[model samples]
Target: MDMTLKDLRIHKGLTQIEASRICNIPLRTYKRIESSVTYLNNPKYQYAFELLDKYVVNKNNECSFNSALVIGAGYVGLSISVLLSQYLDVTVIDINKDKVDCVNNREPLFKDKDIEDYFKNKRLRLTASLPNKELYKDKDIIIIAIPTDFNKETGLLDTSGISNLVKEIRTINKHSLIVIKSTCYVGFTDSLNDKNVMFSPEFLREGHALHDNLYPSRIIIGGDKNNKKVKEYAKLMQSCSLNRAKTLYMSTKEAEAVKLFSNTYLAMRVAYFNELDSFAMNHDIDAKSIVEGVSLDPRIGDYYNNPSFGYGGYCLPKDTDSLITQMKSISNSELISSISHSNQSRKEMIAGDIINRLNGHGVVGIYSIQSKKDSDNKRYAAILDIVSLLKDRNINVIYYQPHEMSLDDFKKQSDIILVNRYHPLLEDVKEKVYTRDLFLRD
Candidate 1:
């Protein structure tokens, strides 16, 4: 049944101004479209339809609580914000004004297919704003998903951001549960010593964050299982999840250990496989053939074994380094430290091999700085280190930037092009391309 635009607007429970603001249409423009019979005849009608593809659902009151606030609008923060907003009100705040604006406009801060879909069609009681104390107070739960970058100088995770935020939150809101989702140094959560402050580490991939949250592998909430607040928050998370993920309760320190150790173990696997690939390359054997043969073992499995430049991303690099530093107290195993050492050696080996292939003097071009084909995130990418190594050897290296230079020009200028991941765009110049991507999957 075709209804008038006014009737449709009323059905969606939006006032004229509210509809205009949420849809990003000017107030005056919306009013004209509503009353004018020429709306279908005018071009403005098409724009209005596109905006109405999604509508805002305000102040959802379905879950354990009505309100939650997430700190840091980066990958972790924004992903969880979109996930939790389905069941309750969620306000995502960040220091960056542009990121905040992006969230408020219902635009993705980064590329995630699930998040993009949810933003357009799902019932999201989500908002984004600058960091405000008033927004922090009165929320049932305050999730701290801010970055705790590993500080090279201090040899510790720079948790000053989380520490200061906790201090501030305690001063204003005493009842709300403050959940720490940021990756931290082992025992960093217990070091805070606040019963209200709990640590729950997120085990999400780089590009597939929200999808993982919806179907989480496990939900580990660190604190006393007996505590009402702890149980309530756990319930809140389970309610949001599509799968009934196993919920594990443990000490804050143990939960912290789980996150660090898990990532370190994955890094170790990467280093292990990368070392194997290095061996295969050294012997001039088919790397993929050997990889497939070894992966045939049932116990070893056939996952996360794709060879690359090295395992260099936000979680693996930072968490492995932090874990290596944290493990210095009791266990002094050279093996744990060597995971990072192995990665370094692998990059150096790769750089040397590339230079040797160039026969000492030639301009080398880099295809992309990103570790993955789809991802734009370049945090701690392995290519950066390789570039540094090449520069030290007096090798002239150029990067293929889409905006500054054309693809054909980039291909034409360099004697040999280095890519961490292979792409079809460079297929025409196959012999000139160099990469370790065996399976051609990220």
Candidate 2:
């Protein structure tokens, strides 16, 4: 199939404005070239395409392994499958029939726009099926991206999802190079004692999984660096990405710690900003200005500088807690240990402030239970905890059901609306809305 200018741009991980800047074309002209076939036939097309060609992934270069078996149709698994499927044939297996059907129907299981566009336009050599022993045979590589839910009882990750599946896949196919992309505890790969097993942690955000894969910050191969498969797999991922990403090879245990530490650091940053915002609120100072001023330092970048109720997404809360658990056995980790507690206190303070706003009596309408705007994922959103705290205080909470409750009706029904991230839809009811989102970009 002939690649369109849009396809090349997306694969190159360049925004329209960036592509325009590189090709010395106007942004409007670039958009027209990408959107219209007639405009794409113009002379501008050749210049733009040729300029961007070197930056895009070259699918012409073939790999040794043509087909891959990916376990779990979750974010990481699905993104990797789509990335490799651009050049290699990939089959994804999930126990969830709904996810399998969605993949087969070219429907995205989540809210990633890149995945949606790829499903609609790109003929990715990808398929999905339910887990079976017969399907696991003869695959070049197998990736495990299942959820490693935090076990509060044990104070560690419940990685049985990965452990059990690895054993099962080994029973079916011992030769396939199995890669562990799931978040695992330290020594997880060592615990398996299998030569083929390796742990390569995924470091992508919730909604932008596929885009991050295409332009990864770093490609890490966590296993015996000298192993032939490990080196080849690194080359495969490097070739598939938009740019030449630096690759790191380390022991699986170090890789496991890298995932935990990286996420814990992010959670720490979130906690830091939330605490700063809390202090600002206590003193009635301008939080945004203080945050912006402090973020001027290059080390303290403004990426995760936005403050909210707390860091309660899929990774931050659980990973921080798990790391704290790991630190308990050591002699000193007081700094690393305080992140979860700070998060909890922030939530309580926010809840208390909300109650003060209500004067201890009012119905609260939730704009969204999701952590971020335009996402269906609510795994551990802070709003849910806030709602629970409100319920404990005898406050009624109602959700914005667009199909049933009209916006005006929803606004009228509640004395206050609790939104973690502000949306324009609630502009009419701004007085009734309560949000801590100062920077407005989630």
Candidate 3:
């Protein structure tokens, strides 16, 4: 039915101001729509209304406390919380009370422009508790989004967390469909013989978590083909969609392999670009221009070609290591090991270049120690290796982020500023600043 704009506004239960705020529409235009002075005659306005309708469910009370719980409140967990909120009453349980509080207050613990509105609008509930047996008992969906750090010495993922969560869920929520979102080895999920279990691998980037979840390239679900639970779970996922993304179904083992191999491919690309940049830097060539020229070719379109210390983020580092470790056990796969070796080599090369640049006995200030630019996070930041390399040679290293550092105080304390990217603030000290960011954008 083509209802009047007033009827639609009332049905959505939004004041014109509130609707304008949520939709990014001009307040005056929204006011005109609400007042019947103007109609949403254009297709663009109609499309905007439809987009909002998809996210903010009209039947507020119809929310089924079809209880869903996300085990960890990290980026992936947060994204899933927002995505699943439409179909189920979702809650995120985390160890950190601060993170839980942020979620409960509908504030993002991390910065993601796409999810900020969802958080602010209380799309999902969040809590932090010592995870009692009762909490998981009645939940229909339980997703594990915890970190699985790779242990270099053991050559395996430290997945005691996953094991513990599985045991606990089996005891408490035997009927709940357990979805493993944590990245794991190829066959790990298949080995778990739990009845209501499946793997749904996440393909989210570090900064663009929610956007990727909402508008995913593809949704990969894995379980026994005949299981009703698996099929129903996939349908439930589709029903909550903000983006009409594609879906792929496979066995649990294949799904797990897809996640690992996908991340490893990204890591491989990063390593390739970093090495390319290194060669260009050695010859004093414009790396970015060369990359732009090469990428303009249809086969090698420009994306993810920016160079850095190495690929060291939440997914790429650990997934590559785990895939390599798992591949090594078979003795048939050699390429996976080489890919991992190349990653390590890239980091080593960056460290070697830094070491060769500095006088072995001076203090060097590291401007922004983050692994990625324009991000506050520093988990597995590749700069740590270069820092360690410098420290071992008795070179004192000072850390400072532009946002965190006071301009006057930072200049007073540092001998040389080692920046990944050149900044105007270091104009006077440019001679002492060492960086390879010929074209700074990550």
Query: What local distance difference test score does each model get?
Result: 0.85, 0.87, 0.74
Which residue runs of candidate 1 sit more than 4 Å off their true CA positions? Answer: 1-62
Output the number of the lDDT-best candidate.
Answer: 2
lDDT of 1 by residue, 22-56 (tens): 66789999888878787778677656654553341
- What is the RMSD of candidate 3? 6.3
What digit string (tens of lDDT, one per residue) describes model 2 on residues 166-198?
Answer: 888888898888999989888878999987888
User: The CA-based lDDT of model 1 is what?
Assistant: 0.85
TM-score-superior candidate, 1 or 2? 2
Clashing pairs for predicted structure model 2, backbone only: none
- Model 2 CA deviation exceeding 4 Å by range: 1-61
Q: Which pairs of residues clash in candidate 3, taking residues 3 or more apart in a chain or in different chains?
A: none
lDDT of 3 by residue, 1-442 (tens): 2334554455455677777777677989766555554445665466556655753564433443366888898889988887777556777888888887877777767868767866665435444454566788778788999988887886767767887899888876667788999887777776677857899999887677786776678889988757777777776665554454677889888998898889888888888878788889889898888888878988876887777777776678888888888887686887667876776777677666666666456667877677665456778777777788777777788877567778767776777777655677788877777766656667
Candidate 3 deviant stretches above 4 angstroms: 1-65, 122-129, 329-332, 401-405, 421-432
